[model samples]
Target chain A: MIEEITSTQNAKVKKWQHLTTKKGHQKFHQYLVEGWHIVSDALAAEQPVVQIIATGEQLDAHQRELPENIETFEITPEIAKKLSDTVTPQGIFAVMDILASETIDPETATGAWLLLDRIQDPGNIGTMVRTADAAGFRGVVFGNGTSSRYTPKVVRAMQGSQFHIDLTHGNLEDWVKALEARQIPVYGSALNDQAEDYSTVTPQADFGLILGNEGQGMSERLMTQTTTNLYIPIKGQAESLNVAVAAGILMFKLNQKLA
Target chain B: MIEEITSTQNAKVKKWQHLTTKKGHQKFHQYLVEGWHIVSDALAAEQPVVQIIATGEQLDAHQRELPENIETFEITPEIAKKLSDTVTPQGIFAVMDILASETIDPETATGAWLLLDRIQDPGNIGTMVRTADAAGFRGVVFGNGTSSRYTPKVVRAMQGSQFHIDLTHGNLEDWVKALEARQIPVYGSALNDQAEDYSTVTPQADFGLILGNEGQGMSERLMTQTTTNLYIPIKGQAESLNVAVAAGILMFKLNQKLA
Candidate 1:
């Protein structure tokens, strides 16, 4: 269906604006992805992109390539600005359906995966997702207390890496138990005597690596459940690494591809 | 000397506000560090913290430990808000002098160092500095076009890692040439057929690693100048890793402590 949305106060526009917020995303079970790159990625990946809204100029430019069935709206530049998070709106946006939570069967789950334990920064969360994809991880789980993957800032940060990997939210403790039941060693990140230097560990084909909150680290309960926690030895005066940077290092270290 | 300045319009308060800008820091060669932790870190490092400013409440809380020789001022909470970059002002701030740039004599230089080529984000620059410190790098050279280390946002992101190691601004072309003159292998990050996997390169105590602008990667000229550009082989679909995260992986790869 094709329609024009000229008023910023239109009911549909108001609903779309709500998708920009966490509460709105949760309530509507939908989120917005702005810019041509993200919208194109969603379409190319065959994700559930339910709608595409763009300024008339943008629609004219991309109209030929857009899929036929998705709902399309022509919006005024003013309406575009109302829905924008960035200072300059790219004028193209998509409404993506949030994936429903599904159970991961211990019997069938394989390949490396990343788990977040209360990792709250959207930028950090997004970077970790991209890094996990780059490291060839099969998926990432947003554990309890972790920000929703559907948060606009996070979806923006993931740079369309979301389409390349599975992202879901679940209790990390349950994730640990599942991976363990499958006989895959799950690694938690921390610094202590029991935490082995990350480089010393042999890279594995199938494993789980859990990164924790920006401030407090992995919960003690989850730390004990992992096969072993690993630490990237800090050789200089820096007390710790940025959570995203730390996640990148550990993911790359534990999941290098076999030649 | 200690004095009370109750108004945000006071000359000192006005000047302190100016210090938050790039032009102001350049003109006066001074930048402000807010919050007690950063302020205290500056004092402990003894990094030419010339003036201390705080509200009466905060001053009373910390006055006993402040150095006797440094000039101190008491200001109203209104002035505190004026100087604060954060929403909730910590009520303590310090003025720090920018270090004078000195020639890096290639003959005397040793140990791993990071080079930034046109990298502009303060947060990325600061995170890279902290990662450099964590990886035990000797220093970082902010090449031409990179954001100033003295930028308030950069300093805040660095979390005082600036004091733990050397930070200087210079032309990266000269830096690469200088390191090469001393028989030090300088590596630029990029992925091409000619580039070697970062992991294949033996870790070195004396080396230089160059990271480039987030979007463009290293300039083609500098890419050719380095001993050999390094590539962290991405096994999956991410277009690229976050610049800071890439730096963390490379720095840790090239500068691991010898057993």
Candidate 2:
């Protein structure tokens, strides 16, 4: 079914405008993804995309590829601009169900996992997710204070990597305890006397790596809970590495051929 | 010496405003850096900080620490906003000379260097430069299409890394040729059957690593001219790593230790 929305104040348009915020996505349990690439990726991944919204021209361009079972709406440029977060709207969007993520038990968990604590930057969060995907990690746990994956800014920066891996919201403290109970080494990144030099730690078949806030290192409680903390020996005068960059180096180094 | 400027229309104030653009910065051979942190770092590095501009409140806060020889201007908050690039003006700025970067002869270049081609994003450029600093690289060369490091957005994102290492603008192709001529391996990053896995290459004491535009890989002309090209294995579905992240991974991996 297809409908035309000429006015910005239309009921459906107002509802979508709300999906631009985290609060709205949480309240309605739906998320909006913009641009052609992401929309097409969502469809390709067989995500639960319920609706397609586009300008008449964009709808005409993409109509043939869109799933016929999904409802479609042709909206005016005004409404498109009003709902867009980008400087120029791509004139297309997909409304998706925010599927609840299931928890993975550490006792049976295999492969590597990344745990982020209090990572507030959307770009950092999204980049880390993408890096984790590229590094072939099993999943990423967003600890408290870390921005939700549903945040529109993170969704945009993620560039579609969210669908490629598992993302779960959890308390990092509990995660550390659970992983440690199973004897899966959980490593926190920090620079201290006791921290093992990262390169010296052989690639592991199963592990959990923790990264924290941009300004602060890992939380005191979480840092103390890990099996051991790892440090990338800083050879230069730079105080530290960017959190996302550090995540990439550590994930690739530790997750090599997770057997 | 201190000068009080009450109005935005003051001749000197108008000139400082001009430094906000590339052309303006080029014409004057000077650039403006905001915030107390940058200003102090510039002073600490003895980087030819000719003038300091700050609001009365900020000037009062930082007065005792400022050098006696450099000229200081106490401007109103209105003038500070006029010259600030950030939403909330830090109310402080330093004007520094754009020192001409002498060409480095590859024969004598001892440490790893990063060469960038067509990297237009300011944040990516700044982040790469900082990563090079953290990885203990000797310098970074901006090829033709990369935004100048003097751009206000790049300067701000660079934090203080700009002062810690050398920044040179040059042709990446020439850099590849020069390094190879000196028996130093110049590596290009590309994913192909023939490209050696990045991890297989042992950390080197002297080499050049080339990164290109975010979307496009290294230029065809440059790719074929390298000593050899390297590839970071992407074990999962992510198409590619963020340019800044890739640069970080490569720099740290190759420049692990100078010896």
Candidate 3:
């Protein structure tokens, strides 16, 4: 039903807010997506979207192209402003069920996979996913303490790469062991002197490159479990590269072998 | 001289606000750098600081660590807050002189360089500088109406890499011609079908990798001047990668051959 929304206290508005927040995302097992670009992407991917809410002006703007099967609601700019997290709301938002991503059988994969450890910033996590997708990575696994994969900032930063690849969250040790069992080599990044230049590591038939957090590099416990610790040589005066940039560099280099 | 900063109308506080506006940055040639980590990074880089101002309490907390050569001043917390750009300023702020970047005799350097075209985000520019530093790029040249290299967000995002590298802003044509004269191949990125995969272009003795804006790719004028127009292979669904990430990948791959 395309109902008109007048009040900010409407149940639908509260639901949208919840979908945007952590508790709501966890309780409902769904997250909010903003902008017509993201909503259009979700529809194009045939992903399950619970609801679509847009302003009268926006709906008119998108009416010719919006799919008929999806449920939609109309709200005023005031209602939309209140519902949006952005200062300049894109006049559209959607609630979609979180996709269930399982560990890939590395034995069958042809490209590299990404392992993110305690990568705190949502923007970094999102951008890394986008980079990984562009570099032809098979999937991305979030180890213990990484940002929520479904956070709005990350999803936006990823620019819909989330829909294109497998994204999983689980224990670090088990994931490493799983890759090993499949004969896939896993490399951890470390700041130590013994670490080989990242380019030196030949990306295996199916390999995983782990990137750590912003403040700290890879955790000592996680580092010890990996096959090798790799380092990107820093030629300039900066202390270290941002984790996402480092991951992008590694992923790109690994893909070069296949190219 | 330690001054009492009671009102937001104080000359220094006004300058901080001015840094936010384009005319202000143009007129003053100064920008704000917020947060403790960034300020500490600037100090560590030994960037010339014209004024180092902090609250009396903050001075008490970090007085000994302040550089002996730099001038220091203490203001009230209220005054410090007025001069700050962030919601929660770390109680330290400084006015640093912008470094004058020298032109590279593109003929002499047989290394990788980055040319940014109309990429507006300051954070992206800063992150790209950090990535360029990590990948051992010779320097960065900005053209095509991009944000100033010295913007506050770029400064904070750069994490002090700006101090360690050469960054210039000006015409794109001359730089390309200079590099070509030196026999250095320039690879410009675009989405055209005639463009080869980025993997196909071997990094010559010296090379220029051009990254375009987020919305617009490379301009036709600049593309025509490039030795080769190339595209990064997007194996999956992503239309493109972040410019910074794309640059990082290209630089890493090119530099690996040299390393």
Please report the candidate that would top lDDT against the real structure: 1
Residue-level lDDT tens digits of model 3 in A8-40: 999878888888778888898899998888888
C-alpha TM-scores of all predictions: 0.95, 0.94, 0.91
Stretches of model 3 off by over 4 angstroms after superposition: A99-111, A256-259, B4-9, B35-46, B76-88, B99-111, B256-259
1 versus 3: better lDDT goes to: 1
- Clashes by residue pair, model 1: none
- Ranking of models by TM-score: 1, 2, 3
Number of the predicted model whose DockQ against the real structure is largest? 1
**How would you encode candidate 3's per-residue C-alpha lDDT over B1-259 as one tens digit per residue?**
5665666677767776676566776787666666556667778767766777777777777777877676666667776667665577678777776555445555465577888889887878999998887777878888859887766678778877776777777577877888888778888988645788876666654688888888788888899999888877776678888877777777776665453
- Clash totals in order: 0, 0, 0
Distance (Å) between predicted and true CA of B139, model 3? 1.9
Each prediction's whole-model lDDT (CA)? 0.87, 0.86, 0.78
Candidate 2 CAPRI grade: medium
* lDDT by residue (tens digit), candidate 1, B16-58: 9999998888789899998887888888887899899999999
- Badly placed stretches (over 4 Å) of model 2 are A9-11, A101-108, A191-194, B6-14, B101-108
Question: Proportion of native contacts found in each model?
Answer: 0.76, 0.62, 0.81
Error of 2 at A85 (Å): 2.7
* Per-model DockQ: 0.66, 0.65, 0.58
